[model samples]
Target: MGLYDIIFYLFAIITIASAVVVVNSKNIVHAAFSMLLTFFGVSGIYVLLGADFLAVVQIMVYVGGILILLLFGVMLTNKIVSVDIRSGSIQVIPAIIALGAFAAILFSIMTSTNWKSESFEIPTTTSVELGNLLMSQYVLIFELLAILLLVAMIGAASIARRDKE
Candidate 1:
């Protein structure tokens, strides 16, 4: 096959594998690491789709920033590391039936939907376009988001710190 096809399949396999690991892994830290890999694989897929800005942002925010914070939170907050948490039942019949029905619905939707590509897409620098939109059309939203992140960071820091009293 072609080079792109090979790369796509490799990334797709890693993505699915990491996702399964993220859900199935017993070790909390290892599960977090697997989740980061899954996020990175998805970003690689975005890059393969020619959405470079989205890919970069996904890697930076989801993998680099959010995942680190989540990992740290797990390590700092939890007293115990590996525990056998009873999540679900051993009955596989219901789960298999649900998965089969969902798959059928998704397959039918995919077969019926004919996706169309735009002939002339306006190509603009994503950062510049985002900045322009943030300043003009969505200034308040941008400011609010910045404030929210700041608040979250401060709150997390406070929670993680040892109490002086």
Candidate 2:
């Protein structure tokens, strides 16, 4: 295999392993940390896929922002560590059925989609292009995302504070 394949496989393995632990781990903190590893591994794989921008975005948004928020949730919600972090007698069968149905739909969509392959000459400057595109075409989307994050932070803080009273 090539360097890309090696790196991709390594990252994929880390991502899957961490993701499994993220869902199954007994400690909430460990689960949060495993999610962090999963996000980092996925971001690394994105970089290997020749999407530097997407990789940076995955790290920044998922790892830096979302994972931190998740960690905060885990920390703030639980005052003391419980013996069994995971709930017992969970409805796994229904979840599996739902996921299987969703997966089938996704597979069908993937098979049906006529994806276009674009060939592009490498531009000397991409950062400027991307910035310009975001500003000119998607500034509203950026503003909306900022507002969403602000709202989430405020809501989480309010909920956390409510426990005090």
Candidate 3:
């Protein structure tokens, strides 16, 4: 109907389609590439929602950092990266039960929750405010994330080293 609606739907479709590709692709490399497209679509949606900082971070953190590392790991490994996806109906009963439980919980939440209908103003200085909050209110959590990333990098390096020896 409107330009915003069209753009939102376009991004949504791209995100969902790419996500499906990422999930269903048998080749790890292709799946990783599809994940990049999905991330890009999500980042676009974030930008549309006036979350520029989040959009940039999504691209940088997920596409640039994690996805690159995943691709590198898959490419550099000696073992086979492509996995055969099995669709056996061995757990049909359990799957049906789980789906039913999930649907019931979702329905209950949707019916019971008081959803907000009011529109909120988007702050122009979102990045500045976010930066200030990270430095002031959430410094510890920020530092912990950095430390966790460092530890993960070290672990990955160690694993790669072991593979060589």
Candidate 4:
């Protein structure tokens, strides 16, 4: 009906289709690439929802960081690319039944709810507010997390080095 609605549906379709590809693809590399598209779709949806900070975080953390790491790991592993890597069995009937039940529950909930459309001011920028809060109130926790990640990296490097010897 509207541009926003069209964009939202597009993102939703992309997310769902890519997620299905990620689940069903036999090749791990293709699955990872599909997952990248799924992440991008989710970030687009977040942007449509007026959550700019979350959208950026989704892109940066999932696409920029995690997806790249996953792709690199898959590429670096010699045995994974050579193998078929398909699951031993498929449970199509059970999956279909579960999907039907979930759809029914969702339809019931949607029908039962009294939907209201109200306009509210969406913040133009959330990063500034978040940064202020993190620096002022949650600085200690943030610093601790950084330290923990640093230690983890050091430990991982040491383990890798020991394995080489």
Q: Of the candidates shown, which would achieve the greatest lDDT relative to the real structure?
A: 4
Q: What is the C-alpha lDDT profile of model 1 across 1-165, one tens digit per residue?
A: 999999999999999999988876767778888998899889989877767788899998898888998877776566655454323336568877998899999999998999786755535446677778889999999999999999998997898688889
TM match of model 3 to true structure: 0.77
- Misplaced by over 4 Å in model 4 are 80-92, 99-119, 158-165
> What order do you get sorting by lDDT, best first?
4, 3, 1, 2
1-165 in candidate 4: lDDT tens per residue? 999999999999999999999988877888899999999999999999888999989999999889998888776664665576443338978998999999999999999999897978887998898899899999999999999999999997887574544
Total backbone clashes of model 3? 0
lDDT at residue 158 of model 3 (Cα atoms): 87
Write out the backbone clash pairs for model 3: none
**Candidate 1 segments whose C-alpha is farther than 4 A from its true place:** 80-93, 119-125, 154-165
- Each candidate's lDDT (Cα)? 0.82, 0.81, 0.86, 0.88
Assess every candidate by TM-score: 0.72, 0.73, 0.77, 0.77
Candidate 3: list runs displaced more than 4 Å.
Answer: 78-108, 163-165
- Give the TM-score comparing model 4 with the true structure, all chains together: 0.77
Question: Which candidate, 1 or 2, has the higher TM-score?
Answer: 2
Candidate 3 residue lDDT tens string, 65-142: 999988887766635454542222366689779988999999999999999878789998589989999999999999
On a 0 to 1 TM-score scale, where does candidate 2 land against the true structure? 0.73
lDDT of 4 at 59: 94
RMSD of candidates 1 onward, in order: 3.7, 3.2, 3.7, 3.2
Candidate 3, residue 112: the lDDT equals 96
Residue-level error in angstroms, candidate 1, position 37? 1.5
Candidate 2 vs 3: which has more lDDT: 3
